[model samples]
Target: MAYDEGLAHRLGEALGALPGITAKKMFGGIAFLWNGNMLVGVIGDDLIARVGPEAQADALAQPGARVFDFTGRPMKGWVVVDGAAVSEDSALDDWIGRCREFVEAMPPK
Candidate 1:
């Protein structure tokens, strides 16, 4: 499964100089981790955002967002935002910020 390099580039720029940011290949795409935890990811031009369980419903209500169901089962605390929704830098940043807030609050793995 080939992911979108263009989206990955935009994600990298959006993550500019963020400490503990790392890229890892997963779910047939690239995932960005914050302090060793999964934050956001680029999967075929879409964004996989870990918004946490508490924000799941709200996150799903966002434009172009849906439950992260790469497999048969849906992930309760994650959402996949369509590429169109995050085409703009600001939109991407908003999603990333939401992911950061979730990842940052968790204990070290």
Candidate 2:
């Protein structure tokens, strides 16, 4: 499977209530964008979070998170969070909160 439907649903529920958020198919899974800036996403059972350069170190320090390296070279401002780490609402919310700060600052595209 390209992605986890259950995880996608749960992510949907977590992000649905926010204004300006939109879900779209991307990178063989799904991504949630806020005003045209990607905030978070799912790939297989992992969660993809864009925490920006400033917060990249802190985000990587979180349990189950690693540098997003889909293209071989590591992406500094992004991370892939393990499904286990985000199984809880609190944990998922924390990711969203971190991503929100960066996404919100981007100009709408």
Candidate 3:
């Protein structure tokens, strides 16, 4: 499965600036890795962030956001940002921060 080249490229660039971050395509989307852990990603036009359950509430409180439900049920500690919202650098940074936070806490794989 293919994704938006433009969005993927932009996301890739942002992740690149982040230290210890890497990315790869998976599940038809892109997965950003931090220390070998899945930190954040782009699934189609949606922005998936691994914010963890503790931070999920606050992350979801943002406009144009929802739980990242990969399966039928919503995944705890993760959220999906509306693609349209990612147009701004600030918005994208917010999602990336969540992912970074998770990765920072997790032991490297």
Question: TM-scores of all models?
Answer: 0.95, 0.95, 0.90
Candidate 2 lDDT over residue span 37-80, tens digit each: 88899999999999999999999999999999988999879999
Q: Judging by TM-score against the true structure, name the best candidate.
A: 1
RMSD, candidate 2, Å: 1.0
Error of 1 at 12 (Å): 1.2
For residues 1-109, what per-residue lDDT tens digits would candidate 1 score against the true structure?
Answer: 8998898988888886998888999999999888889999988879899999999999999999999989989998999999999888899889988888888998766
- Sort all candidates by lDDT, best to worst: 2, 1, 3
- What are the Cα lDDT values of the candidates? 0.90, 0.91, 0.82
Cα error of candidate 3 at position 92, Å: 0.4
Candidate 3 lDDT by residue in tens digits, 24-103: 88868988788889888888887888888888889899888997777888999888888898888888887787777766
lDDT of 2 at 90: 94
Task: Give the CA lDDT, 0 to 100, for residue 63 in model 3.
Answer: 88
On a 0 to 100 scale, what is the lDDT of residue 102 in model 2? 87
Candidate 3 clashes between residue pairs 3 or more apart in a chain or in different chains: 52-77, 53-77
Which candidate should be chosen as best, given lDDT against the real structure? 2
